[model samples]
Target chain A: DARVTQTPRHKVTEMGQEVTMRCQPILGHNTVFWYRQTMMQGLELLAYFRNRAPLDDSGMPKDRFSAEMPDATLATLKIQPSEPRDSAVYFCASDDEGTYEQYFGPGTRLTVT
Target chain B: AQSVTQPDIHITVSEGASLELRCNYSYGATPYLFWYVQSPGQGLQLLLKYFSGDTLVQGIKGFEAEFKRSQSSFNLRKPSVHWSDAAEYFCAVGEWAAGNKLTFGGGTRVLVKP
Candidate 1:
């Protein structure tokens, strides 16, 4: 079975540090998305990519966060100068077609101190 | 802007009992709807989705949802509940105008009792 894979299942970083999360979308999938889940904000779409090109990043913090799909198989999300409020579980999902169903990775739980 | 609303924040049901979770959305144009389930500290799992055809869609884990265009609702339901079914459920709408972004509901936390 195909599934999205995410690395660094958990991350602990101090304020002002840089954090990077990685995701490997299922092979043959053309679309990838990054989402942040927190108690305050249930799930916020940070960014998404189609065919390795970003389709939207408006929901993301432009100054601090960045998402990129380096290749068909890999996507990444980075946070520079992380803050305590940035602590949350980040999930990466992908689908072959841009539609309602998306296959999600296990997720990376980040705690910025 | 497209938005999703899950009226119930939390729901509790006994094992073997029926289950229903409400979800509503607002968006212009035809919308794609979806339901996702998340276990504690886990990523989301797609339960089901509606993209035309029959308004009712069946999904994995014995879950189903009905899409009602007039009410802008896609409610999830199951005939029987299991303790393992307890989790956080999210309803979402996929809109092209929103750059294909999925607007999700606040989520409903299910607590199943034995």
Candidate 2:
């Protein structure tokens, strides 16, 4: 079955370190979304892209977090100078064009010490 | 702006019992609605979605939801609960005019009892 895949399923980093998470969307899907999930906040959308072009990144920390779609298959979210508050499970979901449904990857669980 | 509200933070039901999870939303126009389930350490799975057409939509895992425009509610329900159904459920909204930006609710955790 077609599925979105994320790398580094679990990451533990010291405070002030940089962490990068990668996602490979299902082939031919044009829209991709990045979300962070936590006990207090639940699920928050950090960024999204359509056809490899970013549509929004407003929820992301503009100074330290960045999301980019280098190609149709690859989408990346990076955090510089990570903090303990940044520790959460980050998920990547891709939407099949012309539909309202989205398929999500298993997600990357990050722990910042 | 669009928003979703899942009032129940946690729900407990016995196996084989009926289940209903409430979800409400606020948007200026008709919005796309969805229900998703997440297991521990797993990504969110789309259980169902309602964009248009019939207000009652059937989903996988024997889940269904009814969209009520007057009340701005999309409640998910199941005829009989299973132990495997114990998971976190989330309600989300998407606006077609907004590039399909999704807004998710706080989520409701279902605990199935034997």
Candidate 3:
């Protein structure tokens, strides 16, 4: 079965550290999305890309957070100077053009101390 | 701006009992509605979506959701609950004009008891 894959299923870092999470979308899927989930905020879309081109990243903290699709298969989300408030589970999802449905990965759980 | 709201923070039901989860949305026009289930430590899984035509949409895992334009609601339901159904459920609204970006609700946690 086709599935989205994420690396570093769990990450624990100290404040001010940099953290990077990676995702590999299912082959042939053209749209990729990044989301962060926390107890307080629930789930929020951080960014999304279509055909390796970013469509939007307005929900991301531009100062410290960045998302990129280096290629069709690779997508990454990085956080610089991470804080305890940044601790949350980040999920990567993808879908084909015109398909309203999204297939999500297992997600990366990050904890900042 | 589009938004979704799931009124129930948590719902507890006995196994084999019927269950329903409420969802409400605010949008200017017709909205693309979806329901997703997230098991602990797992990613969200699409349970159902309502695009057009049918008000009642059937989905995987024996789940279904109905779209009511009058109420501006898309509620998920299951005929019988299973222990495996204990999970968090999210309702989302999407707009095609908005690059298919989804606005998700805070989510409802379901607890299935024996």
Candidate 4:
């Protein structure tokens, strides 16, 4: 079965470090979303891409966080000078056109010390 | 802005008992709703979703959720619970106007006892 794939299942970094998480959405899917999950915030949509073009990133911290889908198969979320509060599990999800159901990948857990 | 709320922060139920998790949402127009379950160290799994047509939607693992537009609620239910049902459940609302970005609830932690 097809599934979304994420890299760096766990990452530990000190404050002020840069963190990069990668996602490979299911092939043939046209939409990809990036979300951050925390105990306090639950799940927050950071950004998303449709048809290899970013549709929204308004929910992300523009100064420090960046999300990009350079190609259909690759999506990336990066945090520069990450802070302690940035610790959370990041999940990537993908969906096909004309459907609302999304398939999620195993999340990447980032811990900023 | 659109938002989702799951009133119960945590719930404990015995195995073989019935289960219900409440979900409430706030949005001006009709929105797509979804329920997902997240196991420890795993991504959120879609339990059910409501777009239109029927009010009740059935999902995998014997889970079902009923959408009540008048109450702005879509609650998940199951006839019998199992030990493996213990997980964090999230209710979400999709904003169709804006690339369908989903806003999720704080989540309800379910504990199943044998």
Candidate 5:
């Protein structure tokens, strides 16, 4: 079945550490989105890319978080000096051209100590 | 701006009982509504979506939802509940424009009692 795939399904790290999560969108999909899920915040959009170009990332923390789509199949979210508040599930989703529905990956659960 | 609201934080229903989850939205114009199910610690799965044409839309897993324009509500319903159906349900609203960013609701957690 066609599905989005994410790496490091779960992660635990110390504060001030660097964490990187990767995602592989379904083939032929050009739109990719990054979202963070937490208990306090149900779900929030962090960033989105359209056709390998950054479209909107206003929801993201520009200082510490960065998202990139290096190629059609690969998208990555990275955080430096991660804080405890950053511990949450990160999900990547993608959609093909002109499609309204977004297919989400299993997600990467990050735990910062 | 588009927004979604799922009022019930949690709901418990016995297996084989009927189920309903409430969702409301706010938008300047007609919006694309979606229902998603998320198993514990899993990604959200699309249950159903309503764009246009029919007000009542059928979804997978024997789920359905009706859009009421007067109330700005799109509620999800199931004829019979199953244990596997116990999960978190999210309501989302999106505009199908240049940016398809979806505004999601807080979500409602459903529990099925055997």
Candidate 6:
């Protein structure tokens, strides 16, 4: 049973703080995706990477949000000077290239005050 | 761009009753469809997916979805509902042109009564 793993299952931070969420994709998976879930927005794709190279991050706020796959195993999403509106559950998912299936992580619940 | 729509925001059903959740999609070409279920405080789990060939696809936990290309809909159905089946269901369309990135629906919350 391979699964995507995310760190800091829950995070609480004040406005203007920096928050970092980490994900470990399944060992053999090559594509990684970051998504944010909110009551208003449902699920929004923030960014995705293929072979440790970013494919798109258009949905993400470039001014404050950054997504990176430092290596094959680790993918990270960071928000600098996070705002109250950034409070949402951030999910990390991974899949093998050419496979339409995406395995999701447990998600990190972020609460910005 | 591909988009998905789950019309029902919430549905309540009695245990042992049949269940159906509607999903409609918008895309110019043949699209990859998927259904995922999310339990409270948990990640989304794949229920089923339809790429091609079969219009009706069987999924985990006794769930199935039928794809109707003419209507642009992929509706999920379960023969009988159980109390444990209560969860939020999401419909998604995969955009192959964009590295198969998924566009998810607003989701429908199912509440099963005993």
Q: What is the two-chain DockQ of model 2?
A: 0.88
Select the stronger candidate by TM-score from 1 and 5.
5
The Cα RMSD across the true interface for model 6 is: 0.6
Against the native complex, each candidate's DockQ, computed on alpha carbons, is 0.74, 0.88, 0.90, 0.82, 0.77, 0.86
Q: Listing every candidate in turn, what is its Cα RMSD in Å to the true structure after a full C-alpha superposition? A: 1.2, 0.7, 0.8, 1.0, 0.9, 0.6
Native interface contacts retained, candidate 3: 0.89
User: Clashing residue pairs in candidate 2, if any?
Assistant: none
Question: What is the lDDT, from 0 to 100, of the residue A101 in candidate 5?
Answer: 82
Model 5, DockQ value?
0.77
Between which residue pairs do clashes occur in model 3? none
Predicted candidate 4 versus true structure: per-residue lDDT over B1-114, tens digit per residue:
888889999999999999999999999999899999999999999998899989999999999999999999999999999999999999999887776788899999999999
Which lDDT tens digits does candidate 1 get at residues B36-103?
99998788998998878999999999999999999989999999999999999999998865455788
Indicate whether candidate 1 or candidate 4 has the larger TM-score. Answer: 4
lDDT tens per residue, model 2, A64-106: 9999998899999999989999999999999877886789999
Q: Could you tell me the TM-score of candidate 5?
A: 0.98
Q: After superposition, which runs of candidate 2 have C-alpha atoms over 4 Å from their true positions?
A: none
Better of 1 and 6 by DockQ: 6
Give the DockQ ranking, best first. 3, 2, 6, 4, 5, 1
Candidate 4 iRMSD in angstroms = 1.0
TM-score of each: 0.96, 0.98, 0.98, 0.97, 0.98, 0.99
- Chain B, TM-score, each prediction? 0.96, 0.98, 0.98, 0.98, 0.97, 0.98
What is the per-residue lDDT of model 5 for residues A87-111, given as tens digits with 9 covering 90 to 100?
9999999987666789999999999
* Residue A61, model 2, lDDT: 97
Q: Which ranges of candidate 4 are over 4 A from the true structure?
A: none
Give the least accurate 10-residue stretch of model 2 chain B, judged by summed lDDT: B93-102
What CAPRI grade goes to candidate 4? high
Over B3-88, each residue of candidate 5 has an lDDT whose tens digit, in order, gives: 88899999999999999999999998888899999999789999999999999999999999999999999999999999999999
